[model samples]
Target: MTQRQPRRAYDEQGREIPPPTLADLRAEGDRTAFVHCDATGCGHEATISTDQFPAEMPFPDIALPLRCAACGSKEVGVMRDVVGIYARPRERTGWGMT
Candidate 1:
């Protein structure tokens, strides 16, 4: 027999939200986000995975205090992928062109 995963917890709106864990992060299809150094003229975007942090540590909060590798800046900005590139239409043709 095979074992089944436990159902995720939910709030008033019935959103299935599970605790931030290493297993969960790894299972979430290469979950990635964009980050950059807050220093002026150092806007280099870096793609980091959620699994990079400690399993027990929560997101955003965990990555907030991280420093930039390129500029060695203490301030950093993180961007969550609301609409992933892979999820978008592959063939995108604008109205003006063909």
Candidate 2:
């Protein structure tokens, strides 16, 4: 028989709400990445695929298009660097501290 592990939860502050399991991570279409705006007070959430965004582009720091979903403005500017699989911490280190 196999033992089932408990799921983990996290708060907005990144505090561990609970311990997560392999299944938990696999939920929601294998959710692997998260995205948010760089602007202050803007707490938008966007999910991206690990395969689509190669692990080469700087993630959590890449300069992607910044358009407001609420207002729909093209005049939008890069509020903050976006986050993704390509922007993983290891990738950043591999660049040899740019």
Candidate with best TM-score: 1
Q: What is the RMSD, in Å, between candidate 1 and the native fold over all Cα? A: 10.5
Model 1: residue 42 alpha-carbon error in angstroms: 0.8
Q: lDDT for each of the candidates?
A: 0.60, 0.41
Error of 2 at 47 (Å): 2.4
- Model 2: residue 91 alpha-carbon error in angstroms: 26
CA RMSD of all predictions: 10.5, 16.0
Clashing pairs in 2: 7-19, 8-18, 8-19, 8-20, 38-80, 59-87, 60-83
- Reference-based lDDT, residue 20, model 1: 59
**Candidate 1 regions with alpha-carbon error over 4 angstroms:** 1-30, 83-98
- What does candidate 1's lDDT look like per residue over 1-98, in tens digits? 33332323566776656645544554555376667777998987787776567656544454566789998887786655444535645455332222
Among residues 3 or more apart in sequence or in different chains, the pairs in candidate 1 whose N, CA or C atoms overlap within 3 Å are none
CA deviation > 4 Å runs, candidate 2: 1-31, 61-98
